[model samples]
Target: MRKVILSGMLCCALTATFTIDAVAANSALVSPDRRISVALFIDAHDQAQYQISHDRQPVLLASGLGLALSDRQFLNNIRSIKPSDITEINEHYQLYSGKQSQVDYSANQQQFVLTNDKMQQLEITFRVSNDGVAFRYRALEDKRIDKQSPKPVSVVEEYTRFNLPQQSRAWLQPIAEAQTGWEHTNPSYEEHYQMDIPVDQPSTSPAGWVFPALFKIGNKTDNTWMAITEAGVTANDHASRLQARSPKGEYAIGLPMAAEVFTGKALLSHDTLPLQTPWRVIAIGSLATIADSTLGTDLAEPSAMDTRFIKPGIASWSWGLLKDDATVYSVQQQFIDHAADMHWQYTLIDADWDQKIGDDKLKQLVDYAAGKNVGIWVWYNSSGAWNTTKYSPKSRLLTAETRQQEFAKLHNLGVKGVKIDFFAGDGQSMMAYYHDILNDAAKYELLVNFHGTTLPRGLSRTYPNLLSAEAVKGFEMITFFQEAADKEASHSAMLPFTRNLFDPMDFTPTTFNDIPNIKRKTTNAFELALPILFVSGIQHIVETPAGMKTVPTFVKSVMQQLPTHWDESRFIAGYPSKLAVFARRAGDTWFVAGINGEAEAKTITLDLSFLQTMGGNIEMIVSDGERGFQTHKVVLSAKTEIKLQGNDGFIIRITPKS
Candidate 1:
């Protein structure tokens, strides 16, 4: 029934010969720089399988792809397979709202078109960069006599699986959600990470493991590292996690059977055609390439708004320091004055500001902050309800009209940004709401920050005003749990490689206080380095004006001038739950932070070659054991070894000496 055809698709670094069979075909593509390659083949039955390699060494085993629909039609039949398109994208796009000022988005693109017996089509598009590889599924309309939609297509599950070699291992954080009195099916993306976990091992959680799964492909130094994450996330789609598959297939893209319930209503996504899914990405290369991969942003849509008004900087938050008791104007003014004193850009006036201060008084506070040369960021509950047990405020911005009105009011009130909290989950309805809010927020010139919501999947790229998100087990957890500060050292070490892979984390960094009244587990130096170590478009650090006076003068200086984004980022040493060392350059100046997780002292050898040629003298500060916060004058060189105490941290600032 099908004709056999052979063709060749020439890529940037290599040419893949396509061989056609009675039912399927096979081909291969390589990364633009010739470091990575993927071999794709369709069997006689029309099922598609792909494998990845680095420098000619197999890194990813053969993996199948398909999507199952509720209509009893499996989109597994490869009706026809051939080269779709090849493009070379080389451009530097600026993020009006992100941690990095500019991003280098360059990749070589290739695609494969697959169709089923029902005449329906699914296109798999792949982009290979020098550092990573990404692919996404786009559902197309069937072209046969009765193949179009009005009678739409609904997908139940995506049958994409990640099969790994037997020796490979992953750094996993099992996804969990509570189902009953004692347990949950999803961890709400709050669980601690388990490092170097074998891929074949069994896990207890049925919901599977949280994505952005980092894998160590082999023992080689140059070519065998990989990180699996998703991009181009939309509200129209549900979250995807990796579940263990036995007997051969190592892991799979799993569908969460349960939905998130808000106000007693369950939220689930029923994706329909004319639909496209998020990009499933694999960053493959050396650890440095995998650590600093920007493929996620490449997979996300570009900025949809004018970003001039949406500037990125740090905000002095009131909630972490004063909590509910500080809702009044005087306390809020103290925060503003504190932010102003430190020359920080913004002051966040948290929840209940409306009820506590009222309109006439709130505007005066906004005016006062403006006079201090500081911007205002007010908090609003996205659903508009505070608590179920007590009286709740009606959601004023649920609809388009209300959102426009509310945003206009804030813009008129001179508010720079809005921190919207408590999203329902990753549902089509909620994701649609995100798009609407961002579109409307731009109209009022209001910058945005998402709190108590889903992890970023390149939304910040699409909406630069959407600055930061609180989606992980951040410092705030200490407010409720006693064990929080104890786990701070280890948890902090794991973030950069895992939770921070695809988005800016608002974990609302804490520097003034480690935890209320718990002997500070991490030293003052460690606390101080956070503003630099943690990457957020808006580094919302929690430290009151009075409390901030106790910090070292230079630490305060660095905090005040800390660039929320960077020109470059490099991973230096250590793995999850062990150590994390990194260097970031904002311009001529370089900032570096390193923290140790174990209880014993350890030394790290840092490579300063990135700062080479740009001659600069280094001024270093460390928080090792009881050394307190002391500055050391050290000569700048390519290699420097430093020691840290158990539960310690180190930070250094490099400036060119005249």
Candidate 2:
């Protein structure tokens, strides 16, 4: 047995374990593996702050933590702090759809009770894991702190700040101005990332930067990376973003815009006692550790509903390439046939389905898809004065009664899922709106795909029916303009380390054929690699039937056999916004994908040693020259050297020797 110190002088005994000792003014918490450590203390101004270090090296230095309630401030004039005894957490869980199917979560948790000069108390809980640190604020149930009954309080603002080193480089996307973009659908988390810039650099948009922000400390030699994001957001609270102005590289949390509400409903978070904020997660360590960490889902509440209805597979989409003209019955039927031909699972019919192909015709198309062993996913415009876009099926899902009615109609029509698009923002009301939809959709067993929406923030784990969300600047944007197409190579490379790091992104990637007017920069091989590179439960392929017919037979076969759910995933090599190579395994087969986003060629030593023991054959596909495909069959020993040209990509499939 081991002795552990708690509070100021209290002591307890437990089985031998690893834990940090702390008392009163200064409290330290270390991870189970003793790799990551956190220090919580009160600054000279009596403000609560925390710092983090990995392997004894500083990752985040002196970050502020507190809240500004409508009744009183909770950040300064701290009178006392009581640290709780460290608790150990070790558990295993399975996911229906994610980067990895099996997850083993282990962490050390502790709570700090802080009382200000007013004698009012606030509680902050910290959970330290080997991958990173996660913390959240809560209201205590102690009656001594407040004599009267607990009244509902409003969270005016959060004082949490992430202080990054000035030397660190960042890859962050600027948050869009709410209700400002086309059709007032801005703040949908679709802006291009400001890649590899200084941490102190001000954001282009005054609204600030979006979550899952990636930062590289020191130099390339150091190879230290840290990504900041939030998880477990509930209806009781609002989603948050980093402020635009980072004074001395310290990013403070910012609330949603004034116009971001649910039909002009509640904006600020208002709740009674026994309230808990979302977990502020910081993933720190090497690029591999950051990429492999499942802290986003680990900290989330477990699934309460049965997930037997959730299916992970590829989808054939018509809207991205064919635009509004493709929402007709004939086009949707063709895509359904295309999905059947590719052995895909679903076909998404986007925008104005109600008008373009009336309800009768849509039902007919759904029946036709069912005949072809394909499921139909119809689109909806989740708008009600939040956005002015005139997409049909709009205003039909704003309320629970109407939303469930629409879902029942779709279920009766044999539709498999609904793609809800164009949400306003991340206010408290909007967050609750999302929860309401997910809860209602689960009742009908309808899979949800959120387009023109915010980052998922681990919603898929809680609501397994939520398959994919289009929070990134996806494939549709490439067809709209030349500028967006030009940035595809670099932007795609940054995703695995940022936006797509912990959530399913409906980027609707891949189009082997040409866009109507834009000059597509990335080669066919690059397009082919995306289905395996990106992890989306329902991957909506943008390529049309004609486009699919144009690719090589082997390429079609590869697309047909792609896996949406993975058993495991490992980072192979490369950097953000430049090159990315990853290996994902599904069952006995492994899919290795790599992309080079730069104008020049790059060479990296690939590590396939893990597969050597299994004794497999490597079937590789890469750009033949440019805008072409080439296949190679090789055997690996331990390591292999591969080179990729400008705007190029490659995919390798490892199968057991036959």
Candidate 3:
């Protein structure tokens, strides 16, 4: 506990968390093209604050900027300010699998040097790309400190906040990790989304919302969307999310808390000082613009693994909504046989693979899968590496020495990857564990999928072998609630702009078996389009051999060719949270998918003027005749239109016609 110094009525939110008297000065760093800008300055009370505006409208409100430390350092105080230094950056890189294989971007940067009363220094740097703005703080160690100064460690709290315009709203869900081990996990992360919620009284939850929190910064007509989240999260620090300051307060950056899991006594991190926090990213513009933004991967640290080992493709996964028959050896071979016949790249052998009907049976399945020309992946309880807790079996991976041994054993067994599950928090230890596992997986050239863990912050870029993350309300939830299907269409529409914008999603698309009692949310035709709609490097489809037997052969034929990643991505037309249309290209062929969220029919148009500009007379593979997977060839034109019934989807393929 500490003293609370009384200051004048504090401006709400980041208006002025830290107070000291001073003359106000403001400066902005603009995008090279002058379209996006981030302004920075100190308030009358020397509290550092910043705001972002795109195309001349405020996207982020005036918010406080600083960190509170148990060490009592006032890191955001501005003793004196130097005009910001401006710099220009232009670069390009290749993604093993993404909306696009290559990305070209340029941005402008503005940096300021700030020092507190004690002469402790900190730097606030902002990068304003045409697509978004990201800011990070660097604590500069002062050499003038006494030799006896204790090594500065840990972040007690964060003052960084996003005060959205009152008219603006957010699409959010509570974190599942916070409720994982609790007595009642009612508000688990697996719950449905609360859409288009106003900022003033954001949500009913006391725990706040999760990352990639999508916010619409203006009225319906203004249509400016922005997501407030973090990126480049390293082992040195834990990841963070927005929490309402008061139950009715605006959102502020804070660590995840589950009471028992993250006791108030536990701070955000213990990394040494002179540290740089992960970037707080704001991807601006429309849902499509959010989907097209490169800031997420751009802000992430680059890959540390050989690109050769990173093979991202559609895998057949067990232990999800459907695949349960494979509990024993004989039945497991059928999945391998089907995977080979379908030409799918990988088959995941989920949990319980280590018991008596286990490794021996697993080896048989592994060898059988290999001959069938398919690779195998397995799931493990990451915590069990240390002790038996939660899903941790005695065979779990806990220590580095053990991780090495496990990876080696799996590697020799011909396992292509591992899905480490049940990471219930995002504290420093949890964050470090993620990093350590990524490094170890890299050594064995094993790709990874993180389940029951914090959202991926472009870790796939930093460690290319780390594939998809199942942190979203994916297809698995369909097995849990009847309402799951009711929410699917809008949820699918919202995901591209929200969750999938920054990280690849493992929605486990393409399921055909009807639920026992609940009405299926979408059509097999709509389901046919998911491989194109939801973007993930490893697009795991939840189809078991038994389930696929009942699916239409034509639909299965198209499902066989869903591209896991694209060479390019573009946002087409549609309203937010209602309807969405997306276009992606893998190479010479292009895939366009649309989802209709209404209870009645809706129509949307496609303008192929871009294709015409590239001078191509193409073949059109249309799926709009009351059948989603019905494929037909037609001469492509600059304009085409179609009508979709409520809760339905459609897809079209454009390939050049010689």
Backbone clashes for every candidate come to 11, 0, 9
How well is each residue in 303-398 modelled by candidate 3, as lDDT tens digits? 756778777877877666544444556656766777776678888877666753477778888888888878888878765322234432334466
Error of 3 at 350 (Å): 0.9
Cα lDDT of model 2 by residue, 236-332, tens digit: 8899989998977899898999888888698888788766889999998899999899988888877798888888788998888888888888778
The candidate maximizing TM-score is 2
TM-score of each: 0.90, 0.95, 0.89
lDDT of each: 0.71, 0.85, 0.70
Per-residue alpha-carbon lDDT of candidate 1 for residues 455-480, written as tens digits (9 for 90 to 100): 67778888888888777778777665
Q: What's the distance in Å from true for residue 216, model 2?
A: 1.1
Pairwise lDDT winner, candidates 1 and 2: 2
Q: Which residue pairs in candidate 3 have backbone atoms (N, alpha carbon, C) closer than 3 angstroms, thus clashing?
A: 14-64, 20-45, 100-567, 176-189, 384-396, 385-396, 385-397, 385-398, 386-398
- lDDT order, best first, reads 2, 1, 3
